[model samples]
Target: MDRPLVAVGSVIFNGDSVLLIRRLHPPNQYKWAIPGGKVELGERLRDAVIRETLEETGLLVEPRTLMGIIEVFKEGYHYVILDFICEKKGGELKASSDAGDAKYFTLNEIRKLNVSSTTLEMLERFWRGEKMPFMITEISK
Candidate 1:
């Protein structure tokens, strides 16, 4: 793509578990990651996160805090992703849209899954309850 796409992702939490989805699309196809997708033109970041989460995981969530920003570049495509810590509001858990599977996992369970390095770092911060300081990460596939 010519320009970087703006995307939003949510690290939805309920107690000690967090939401994860097995992506059915490229960039991380078949791999587990937080629910999210590209932000539509004129859409707010918070709205994008909520919409993406619902589209991928069938969950309605309320974004609580912004976790951080990640910049990913691979094969001529670039994306600037904003990640948020969200709380479950309502809706059933099921895979939909770009997700092949959607489920909740404890931190220990997440450690054993096939996930992106960026996601791992974000999870670590979330688990520790670290006060994220608007971090910017770059990932190259």
Candidate 2:
């Protein structure tokens, strides 16, 4: 068995609303999610999220603290994610090729927003504001 043990993610927030970006890529089209992606080789964790956010949303952000980490397993593959709490640092709002759209939304909106199961779960846990130990789980059958 092989485990895919590498990836990064973020939970960018604007006051009560968290920023969600629509994936412009295949498979996740029209679906919403936090602005993040996989960690590149030799890239720092924070730097990877920062870079991914800018590339996806065109907004520079300074990540604060790592909120949580998730391990999703399905079909013999593992997805390791680092969910960070970040704030806008600079740059005018612009959507890029990776993200079809970007905007902030309240937690309630998140409940109504269409997103990947992992993304939605991460958002809900983040909204609670509890300092939690990095949560790790395997989404399996």
Candidate 3:
């Protein structure tokens, strides 16, 4: 059996808007989601979130809260994703690396986009200012 891949994602906020990326690859390709990606070996979770966010959105962010954890299983791939709420520290907004596009969006604006269900749920909870406990999920193959 293979170990599940570990990933990190961030809900990075700038004022009343949140940063989002249009994925350039599979597993919801072309869909809008928070900036993040797989955690490299030996990387800390917080560090991974920051690095992934920077790589995808060109923004330096500070992870403020551990919002939740979600397990995604599809086909033969399994991933454990750590989700964080982050504050922008610096850097310009430009899509690069794993993202096709990146931008900030208000909650209402976000609802108009094509997004993953998990991402939508997370955003809704975030907009409500709900304190989330750690969560785990397995996507049926």
* TM-score per model over all chains: 0.92, 0.84, 0.90
Q: Which whole-number lDDT from 0 to 100 does residue 95 have in model 2?
A: 77
TM-score-wise, the better of 1 and 2 is 1
The CA-based lDDT of model 1 is what?
Answer: 0.85
lDDT by residue for model 3 (1-141), tens: 379998889888778888889998866789998889999989998899889988898889999988878788865778888889888899898999989999888888888999877777777876787786557575866
TM-score attained by model 1 = 0.92
For model 1, residues 8-76, the per-residue Cα lDDT tens digits are: 999887788888999888777788998999999999999999999988888899999888888877546
**Model 2 stretches astray by more than 4 angstroms:** 26-29, 74-77, 136-141
Alpha carbon lDDT of each predicted model: 0.85, 0.77, 0.85
Better structure of 2 and 3 per lDDT = 3
For candidate 2, write residues 1-141 as lDDT tens digits. Answer: 454766666677667788888887733458897788878789998899889988888888887888887777755567777888887889877779689898888878877878777777766765666577467575756
